[model samples]
Target chain A: MEDNGRTARKRAQILEAARPVFLRNGYVGASMDEVAALASVSKQTVYKHFTDKEQLFTSIIMDTTAQVEGLTKMITATLDDDGDLARDLRALARGFLGAIMEPELLRLRRLVMAEAERFPDLGRTWYERGFERSLKTLAAAFGRLGERGVLRLDDPELAAEHFVGLLLWIPVNKAMFRGGNDLYAEADLDRLAEAAAGAFLRAYASPDTA
Target chain B: MEDNGRTARKRAQILEAARPVFLRNGYVGASMDEVAALASVSKQTVYKHFTDKEQLFTSIIMDTTAQVEGLTKMITATLDDDGDLARDLRALARGFLGAIMEPELLRLRRLVMAEAERFPDLGRTWYERGFERSLKTLAAAFGRLGERGVLRLDDPELAAEHFVGLLLWIPVNKAMFRGGNDLYAEADLDRLAEAAAGAFLRAYASPDTA
Candidate 1:
């Protein structure tokens, strides 16, 4: 059991080291020797943890999906708040932007999208596991809001899409193209979040409820 | 004057040939020799027209921005229609989606975004020239609609962003990640466009006007 625990710890250490290397160098340019060296482990141990560069890259991406769990929880907690719908949604939008617009997350996004052509399966898995999962959770929350007459939507899933679409489309595209996160100030993000929540409310809020 | 025309024609030819090569090989892998050979022009002629591969690539991207003029015209003509507002908006939405979702355009977008880190200026220029130009035109049209009391937006720019966000967030992201345009059928696109227009109307249509 102790040996197994030590092996798991070593594997985690390798993945921690591999993330920045892959982010910096991209898949084609990244070298196993560099990853092993960065991990302070021998190439054999790196190979023992991950069979090859592709496996290591895939593991790194797949592991990032776990971060979405925090977002899922945030969505549930924020939407479930029995407060002002607009206020709650704005806070949720801010949280959504804050989580997604992290420089590391944005870099990972760029890295995944940049290599999506060469690694179709990795791209698809990342989109499904990371992007779609969060959408699904938000959809469920919207459904609950609709049931309570807090919102008026024929389709909760579509509303969820609109909410995120309004919030993310401009900032994410700017970040993706500009290759940086400094484009938007905190004030700008807050304004964008407020605009998205306001638009969503206008589109879906129960006419009488608001 | 005839010699000047010929020079211009050769420049055009070189640019036309360079597009596919860049699309296929990306920035790092593309070669001037391949572009000249494909254009059936001499390498010396290619050099005379374009100083280097970077200049050739930049010119190709900058040239494509002219296509947005056509879209701007389309938006004005479609939205100015004296017919049903819903029908007009749906037609506009459909056109917007069809234009942006072209495979060649998607490929160009991927090419620009992939090299965004390496060529920050190129990416910024493309985003501003191509992407922002379209949004600004759409916003102007939405502003006209607001003046006529057809829409109820206090901010036409935000409304334009929401309109595009609703229509494009899902499809564009899917294309960016999956590296293909086959994810949606013609009917699916129509439905998406319809949904976007519906949501936009719900959000912005003058309560008494519609």
Candidate 2:
């Protein structure tokens, strides 16, 4: 490995700084000067690595997937590890919900969503890096679960989408509308995990009929 | 009966004028001058009716609801008359989906959701007028269906939430990020509606093993 840890660290700092500016000002409104000031880096340093604002945003989103890719590896690895499926699913839900709710992450999403009319490619990139990567992790987990005779599912991908949809939608949508900040607390998360897991079992689990 | 027809029409005109400007310039950025100019009314005329920007916006939103409320009533009434549950649901879904995708409505929604962080009351107004009202309609329909023995449900409210969640989440979220210009065509709408209704039944229909 080429010890580029310092460079990685700087890049992380820049990305973190850029996120709020992009969120507050949206894509077309945000300026490099504000991002540089927030990151405490010189404008020359900011441009040295990224070619443009789009490229900088593209990098920040890629960072999101890098994180997803790591967790995905472990989620797949644990499919046969004797972990409770509900626990595993809950952990995955927690991860997904947490990712979607990060203030910077939420703002990043809003910025793309808000600017999507004028900037389709930004939304496309964010979706490709964020949601698609998470879907793959869930799909892999479902495939492994089916193979282990724990469940029967014809389309693992759709099942994954449904499961993840439960994890997100309500809390995330409410947050998008400014209604769920206090609602997603610890008990709320537990309720979400239970509701999602129970409903999932009701639809897919073999007739234990419990 | 107080017709108030001209007053209603003038209010409608004001809302139509206000919605686009608010979408383009955001809540704080938009000015009454632009709203008045767009409405073809004098700035004095604008102020004569609504006292301030907040009240003006609230009245515009309420008036918009009074107008757009007809779509839901039309859909629900048509479904109430006669049709298979699944077919009726599909038709309602198509109508509902189409209405939301209207360019002007989509833009308005984004403006409300975007500025929801700063002015929370606007977001609450949106939920009260839009999402909550929609959810309540679904619950009422399902409640009637349950009583008629066409369906079985303990909580139609959650079921309604789930149904709305599925239909609205993907396309609406996509629109939130990408604008609603190229949503499903007729054939796509049919397929989506059928799929949604089918998936919903698979989970909620009464136990047939009896």
Candidate 3:
């Protein structure tokens, strides 16, 4: 049992170190030697945890899907608030912007996309597990809102897509192309969240609900 | 006059050859020697037209911005039609989707974004000249529609952003991550365009306009 615990701890340490190395140098450019050095572990130990560089890169991306669990909870909690719908939506959007705009997340996103062509399965898995999971949760919340007569939409899933599209398209694209997250001021993000929520309500809100 | 014509012709030849080379190998991996060999021009001729690899890449990107002029014209022509507003908007959306979905253009977009960190100025120039120019034209078209009482919006630019966001957020991101443009069928694109136009009209169309 003690040996197993030590093995698990070493594996965790390798994963933690691999994230930054992958983020800094991308998949093709990152080296296993660097990861081993950064983790302060023997190179043999690093390979023991991850069979190869591709395995390590895949492991790191898969690990990030866990981060979205927090976002799922936030979406469910914020959208379920008893406050005004607009305020609730604004808060949700703010939460989303805040979560995605983390510098580490942004760099990871760029790295994933940069390598998407080379590693198609990694990109698809990340999209399905991390991106679509959040959308599905949001869609369920929107469906509940629709059923309660708070919103009027034929398709809650489509509405969910539009909600995120409106909020994320500009800033996310800017970040992707500019290679940084400092492009938007806090004031800018607030205005964007409000604009997206406002537009969403205009399109989907029931007259009585407003 | 003959010498100027020869210089212009050589420049065009070099650009035509450089596009494929850059697409196959990203900025860091692309080579000037390959460009010269592919252009059927001597290295001296290639250098005569472009100062360095960076200059060559920038010129390739800058040259593509002219393609947006075609989009601007299409927007004005399509939206200014005497046909039904919904039909016109759908057609415009369809055109927008078709234009951006070209395989070469998608590859170029990935290349620009991939190198964005290393070539901040090139990315900024591409965004301002190609991306923003199209959005500005769309905004102006939306403003004219507003003035004509067809659409109702206090901010045309925001409406334009929403229009594109609704239409493009899914497919563009998918392409960016999947590294292919075949993810969406033609029928899928038609459905997406119609949905976007439907949502935009719901949010911004004048009540009497419909």
Candidate 4:
């Protein structure tokens, strides 16, 4: 049991250390030597945990999909209740914006996109496991809301897509192209959240509630 | 006069050949030798036209901005008329979607985003010249529509942002992450365009017009 715990801790350390290296230098440029040095482990130990650089990078990306679970849970908890749909949506949008805009997350996203052509499977898996997974979860939650008379929608899935599209398109593109988080102030994101939620509500809220 | 025309033709040939090289190999991997060979020009000719790889790549990106001029013109022609607002918006959405989804443009977009960190200036310039330039033109058109009571909006810029956010968030992200054009069929994009336009009109159209 102790050996298992120690192995798990070392794996975590290597992943944590390797992430910045990949984010900084990209896939082809990243080196296992640097990852070992940053993790305070020998290169042999690094290779033992992950057989190759591809495995290590794929592991780091797959790990991020777990983070999306929190957002999915937030969707169910907030929207599947009787709370004001607009306010709940704003809160959800704020949460999503904040989550996606994390400096680390943004850098990881850029790295993945930069390497997508070279590593097509990595990009597709990340999309399915992280991006599309959240949208699917959000769609289910919206379906529930529609049933409860909180929203009106012909297709719950399309509504979920539009809700996020309305919220994330501008700021995310700005950040992706500019390559940093400083482009948007907290106030700017808040206003974006409010505006997106308002627009979404105008489009989806029940006629009586709107 | 003939000498100047010859110089211009050589410059255009080099730019055309260099684009695919950069797009295929990315900025770091692209070679000037391959560009010269592809263009049927000598290495000296390539250098005489553009001082370095960076200049060549930047020139190629800058050249694509002229394409956005067509879309902006379409926006005015479609939205500025006293025609049906929803139908016009769909046509505009279809035009915008078709333009952005061109296989070559998508590839260029991926290349620019992939290199954004290393070549921050290029990314910023492309975003400003290609992306924001179109949005700004669309915003001015929307503002005119608001004045003519075709649409109701307090902030035209925000309205424009919402407009694209609704339209582009899904398909663009899908294309960006998946690294190919075959993921979405033309019928799929047409349906997406229709959905986006319908939602945008619901959010912004005047009550009487809606």
Candidate 5:
């Protein structure tokens, strides 16, 4: 029974170790041996848990889908609470920045970007898990904004895409891509989120709307 | 005289061949021998023309810079023409779309983005040359918009960033990043450009301040 418990724990450890290796090495550069070594598991054990690199990486990203979930759920509820628009947006931005800034998530994004050329499937998965889902959550927020009459938007979905598009370059420059200016400090984050939300409201808010 | 002419011609060929090779292999993945072979020049001649790989890439990007110049120059002149904001902005968006669609430039952008992780200098150069310069041009256009009193003013630079930021993601995903979207045909360019411009103008134009 103790040995069975140990095996279960070992399987989880291997999966966790595989995440960084795949992120750091990408698809082509990464190897199973390195992941096993990192996990302190035998080669056969890795095979038992994951049939292939793609499977392992896909599971890695999906399992960590929890990372973005907290921010999404938090913002959706907060955006509904009728807090000030600028304040709400800044809070939302902090959540987003905090989530992406985690060393693990940052590495995951880098790995997806690096391997995007050869194994575009990984990039698509990352986009689906990260951007697509986030956009849906954001659209829900916009829907609330519409209901509040703070903005009259014909299509919250397109508006959400436009809003999130502004931030795509932000992460690309600051973290994964490197050599982008320093990551945002607290004040910088506050300023950018406010400016962005303000501009978005100004542009999208129907004249008679919010 | 014959040898000198042949050498100059060979140098041009090497640069030309380099675009395709660099696009496919990435900066580090590319090799001089392959470039020499593709150019139909001796390795010695390739070396004679470029001191090293970095110089070679810089030269290729410099060549690409010329391609970006004419479009913006035309837009700036058109924007300055009695502040014809509509025509000017339409032309600018079309120009941007046209620039974004060019196959070679698109490939160069992807190559730079992919290789940027390992080579931070390339990312800086790309941002300075491609992103910053383009922003400056847009700011000037917005300055003209303000001069015409069609728009209210804060920071023209930030306004310009927002303007371009709106359309930046689509082509980047389609052409450069290969995120699996069909490229827009030439016929739809102006229409697509105009819609985005109109949406932008609505948010931006100071209550029909014109």
Candidate 6:
């Protein structure tokens, strides 16, 4: 058990060190020597943890998806309860905006997209595990709301798509293209969250509530 | 004047040849030898027209933005006239969807994003000339609609952002990550466009129309 725990800790350290390496230098340009030095391990130890750079990079990306689990839980917790629908939605939007727009996350996003063509499975897996997982969670919550008569929607999945679309379209694209997060202030994100929530309510709220 | 015409033709050929090479090989991987050979010109001629690979790449990306002029014109032509707003909106959405989802364009998008960090100015220029230019035109049209009392909106730019976010959020991401255009069919795109138009109307249409 002690041996296993030590292996796990070393594995975590390698991933933590390798993520910024990949993010900064890109997949093709990133070097194993840099990863080993950053992790404070020998190259042989790095190879023991991961057989190749591809494996190491994939582990780093998959590790980021764990962050999405928190978001999925937030979606369920916020939308499943009996509460003010718009208020819950706006808060949920704010949570999502904040999570996705982290500078590190943005950098990782660029890295994934940058390497996506070279590693088709990496892109596909990230999309399924990270992006779609959150959307699916949001969709299920929206479906429940639709059934509960708080929201009126023919398709919960489509509604969820629009919800995120409205919230993320501007800032996400800006950060993706511009390579930084300074474009929007905290107040700007809040306003975007409110606007997305407001538009969603306008589109989905039951007639009486609307 | 004859020399100038020949020079223009050779420059165009090099550009055409260079685009596919850069798209296929990526920035760091692309070779000027391949570009010159493909264009059936001397390496000297290739360099004569464009000083370096960066210049060639930037020119190719910027050249693509000329296509956006058609979209901007469509926005004005469709929205300016007093026509069926829903129908016009759906048509415009369809146009945006079709133009952006072209397989070549998708590939170029991935290329620009991949090189975004390496060539920050290229990404910024593409975003400004290609992405923001379209949004600005759409916003102006929506602004006109709001003033004409055909739509209700406090901010036309935000409305424009929401409009695209709703229309593009799903398919664009899918294509970008999957690295293919086959995920969505013609029918699927039309359906997405119609859905976006319907949702936009729900959120923005005048109450009298509602």
The top-ranked prediction according to lDDT is 6
Q: Write one digit per residue (lDDT tens) for candidate 3, span A58-175.
A: 9888888999999999999988876699999999999998888778887788888778778888888899899889999999999989999999999988899999888898888878
Query: In DockQ terms, which candidate is top?
Result: 4
Interface RMSD, all candidates in order, equals: 1.0, 2.3, 1.1, 1.0, 3.0, 1.1
What lDDT is obtained when candidate 2 is compared to the true structure? 0.69
Q: What is each candidate's DockQ, to 2 decimals? A: 0.76, 0.42, 0.69, 0.79, 0.40, 0.77
Q: If you assessed candidate 2 against the hidden native complex, which CAPRI class would it receive?
A: acceptable
Better of 2 and 6 by lDDT: 6
Chain B TM-score, candidates in order: 0.96, 0.85, 0.97, 0.98, 0.86, 0.98
Candidate with better TM-score, 1 vs 2? 1
lDDT of each: 0.90, 0.69, 0.88, 0.90, 0.69, 0.91
Query: Tens-digit lDDT track for model 2 on A84-176?
Result: 766666666666666667765665566566666666776676776767776777787787777766766777776676665555677776777
Per-model TM-score, in order, reads: 0.96, 0.83, 0.95, 0.98, 0.86, 0.98
Please give the lDDT score for candidate 5.
Answer: 0.69
Q: Residues A39-66, candidate 5, lDDT per residue (tens digit)?
A: 9888988988788877887778767766
Worst 10-residue lDDT window for candidate 3 chain A reads A173-182
Comparison by lDDT, 3 against 6, better one: 6
True contacts kept of each: 0.67, 0.30, 0.52, 0.71, 0.23, 0.70
After superposing all C-alphas onto the true structure, candidate 5 shows an RMSD in angstroms of 3.3
- Candidate 3, superposed: residue stretches over 4 Å from native: none
Candidate 5 has what TM-score?
0.86
- Candidate 5 residue spans exceeding 4 A from truth: A1-11, A61-64, A97-107, A167-177, A180-183, A208-210, B1-8, B174-192, B208-210
- Compose the digit string of candidate 1's lDDT tens values, residues B29-104: 7998899899998999999998999999999998999999999899889887767889988999999999999998
lDDT of 5 by residue, B54-159 (tens): 8898788667666556766876786677655666677778878777777656556656655555677766666667656766887887887887677776878767
